[model samples]
Target: MTLETEFERVSMPLENPFTISRGTQTDAENVIVRVTDEGGMTGVGGAAPSPHYGETAETVEAVLPDLLTAVEEIGDPHALHAIEAELSTVVTDNPAARCAVSIAVHDLAAKRLGVPLHRLWGLDPSAAPATSFTVGLDETERVREKAADAVEAGYSILKLKLGTDRDRELVEAVREAAPDARLRVDANEAWTAREAVRKSEWLAELDVEFVEQPVPAEDPEGLRFAYERSALPIAADESCVTLSDIPAIADRCDIANLKLMKTGGLLEARRMIAAARAHGLEVMCGCMIESNASIAAAAQLAPLLDYADLDGSLLLADDPYDGIPMLDGEIQLGAQAQAGTGARPKSVE
Candidate 1:
């Protein structure tokens, strides 16, 4: 059956000003894609652009019209890889836009089979690991407050944004606020090799799980130097973008942080998980600050992950779609008998 496609740009407001190594954002700029088959089964997807990855809302939106046209030309929602190949030829470098199309196709395939995405992939929902809610860079008091609030809300794990010189104080405050919660930190490529090793030692003392992307993406040698002596496990975020980038940094990191927008789609993401595992690196399925559309698509692959950082939707003040349901920090997907990614578009009322 021929597939019909459409897209819309959405700006999802953040609950708080989200700060990372790159800067801050008060809203998540996203693009939503909807696909409907001749049989009337519908599938949806979303993309959250990050300037760090060289994609913005304008870039994503600029590529969507041609992307939609390409999807219509392809005509078959089940041919995900084929659609992906066609999309690559249609547009280059817009991974977020590519991700939106890839996700919509996967969603349509699962919907056509009358099963949730995890079920279609032969995955177990119960085995899906708990996700970590993020606490962005904020004032020490606000950071402590946010940590306490997350713990009080029943979340067992918290991922904190770190990079500034106040990193030590911020982590210490949160540790004091939520003594029992498992903690992880993302440096967003803010540290130098020496600084990464030094910070990792300090972070390890506080029981931080792992340090993500300490050195900038441009410096592979720096990551290697830090990896040699880092007291905490180092996960590659900025340094690892696509499949090809994996082999280059495989020895430089202990973990691979896979995001749909980074890899361009669910199919490539699945490949990334397998590739990471093949190389003896643990897999972390992560996301940008996004709506439920992208989070839901990523959730379908959670069972394959060693760690999950899929808390993008949790940061949104209001989401345009409902997909994965996260309680505390755990993902609930056992009852998604509906087709697609099980995320339904919400009325903009």
Candidate 2:
């Protein structure tokens, strides 16, 4: 029987300013996709705007209507693969929107099969430990304040967003703010290869665990060069999007940051994780600013990943759905299993 598909937008305001190399954000607007089967089981998914990656509310909104129409025309929720194939043909760009629709389909499919999303992805949900919370770039005092808040809130690991001129100062302030916390840094491809290596020297002094996307996405050679020179482990973010991008980045990066939006959906993300593991790279599950829908989708992959950054929902001032509870800095997998990842808003109907 054919299923029904619908789309809408949810706006989540950030508790504080979220700044990166691309831009700053106070509110996170996400595209929410809902899929309902003939049996009445439903699954939800979210796609968050990554302005740095050229995604925005307007762009996602524009893309979602057509995507939903095409998917609904296909009707059969079980024909997810075929539906995704058809979707690729219609929506040529704005992968984040495609990802949202794809994830919703996967969630609905899992529900229909009477299995959790993680099991469908071939992962043991219990294996995913706590995720890391991010501290965006800010003044030292503000950085410390945020770090302190996260630490006090029960997060043991903190990912400090750096890459600008005051990288060292930010790290130091975070360190002071959360003395015993496990700290790491992400450059988000802001540094040149040379600058990455140079900055690594200073970061090493702060005992930063790893540095993510220190150089631009296209500079695999530079990434390798920086990896060789730095004592800190390098993680590939933008450089490693699809499974195809894995082999090239494997030798250069010690870790890979996987996001649902980048991988398109759980099926592809599972494949990417297996490939990354085969290449002997650790996996880090990350996310853009989103509500429970997006976080829940990524949570399915959390058990298999070495690091977790599913703090997207936690940063929001208000979340429309009760998807997963991120307590302290760790994601409560047990809670996730009980609640399931794809919890939809009651208003989604």
Candidate 3:
């Protein structure tokens, strides 16, 4: 059936500074897409650009108008393969923007089909677990306080933002604050090969479950080297963007951090996971700071993953739509049964 398209930019304030190698952000601006087929079924999607991945809100916003224009021209949500193929030509290389539209289309199609997104992708929705909450970059005391707050809020798993002058100290402090919580750290490609090795040693002492993107994305050799030396499992974030990037990362790292924006959409992300498993790499689905719409899309892929960082919705002060309900770190899929992308478009008129 033919579908209509609408687009907008939504800004959500972060609870604290989200810092990584690229810069710091106090607010998250996401590109939002809505698709409504002639059948009256609708779906919503959101795209958030990560500066660490070399994208900004400005770039994401700049690509949306053209993306909406292209999708409206195609006018068919069910013709996903055809529409996606056409999108590549018009949208080009902006995966974040493409992801927004892809998710919205998927939602619309799924809603029309009357099935949850996981079932559409051949997954059992009942098996999906809760996601992890991220502890943003901050001072040691403040980071510890945030960790405590997350724990108090019923978060079972906590991912800490690390990779600075005081990486070790921060981890130790966070661990001390939330001793029972499962802890993991992400450097966001800030460290050197040598520093990764050194930090991995200290990190091992904190009993961290894994360390993500400890070194720069380009240094596969460094990742391999660190993997060989560290007791902690290494998760490749920036290092593994596409399916082709998986084989090398699987050989070098233990886990893969799959972000929808990085792979473009669920289609590519599914392929990337298959490739990662063939090479014995564990999968962890993650997302940039986004609203419930984007987080809901990523949650559909959560059951297939060993780890989940779908905490983007938790970071927002307000989420306009109740797209996905997260309870005590666990994603409550039962809250929305008909998933076909799980996000419903906001009212444009």
- The model with the greatest lDDT is 1
lDDT of 3: 0.81
User: What are the per-residue Cα lDDT tens digits for candidate 1 across 1-349?
Assistant: 6878888898889988898878889998898999899988878889899888789989998999998898998898888889998888899789999999889888988888888989888999999999998999989999999999999998999999999989999999999999989999998989999999988887999999999999998999999999999998999988889998788888999999999999998888888888888899999988999888889989989899989999999888999788777887888888675677878877776
Local lDDT at 136 for model 1: 94
lDDT of 3 by residue, 1-349 (tens): 4667777888888877787656788888887888887867777888888765667778877877787777778787777787677767787778888888888988887887788888777877667777888987888899999999999999979999887788888998899899999998998888887888888887888888899988887888988888888778999988888788987777789998889988877677888989888999899988888887788888888778888898887787766655666889877676665557665544554
TM-score of each: 0.97, 0.93, 0.93
Where does candidate 3 stray beyond 4 Å?
A: 344-349
Worst 10 residues of 1 by lDDT: 334-343
Candidate 2 stretches with Cα past 4 Å from truth are: 337-340, 346-349
Model 2 lDDT tens row, 1-349: 6677777887778888898866788998887888887777777888887766778878988888888887788987667788777777788777788888888887777777777777666666568878888899887899899999998899999999987778888888898888898888999899999999999898888888899999999888999999999878999999988889999898898998888877766667888989999999999989987888878878877888899888888888878876766767656656654333656664664
Models, CA RMSD each: 1.2, 2.2, 2.3
Residue 107, model 2: lDDT of 79
Instruction: Report the number of backbone clashes for model 2.
Output: 2
- Model 1 ranges off by over 4 Å: 347-349
State the TM-score for model 3: 0.93
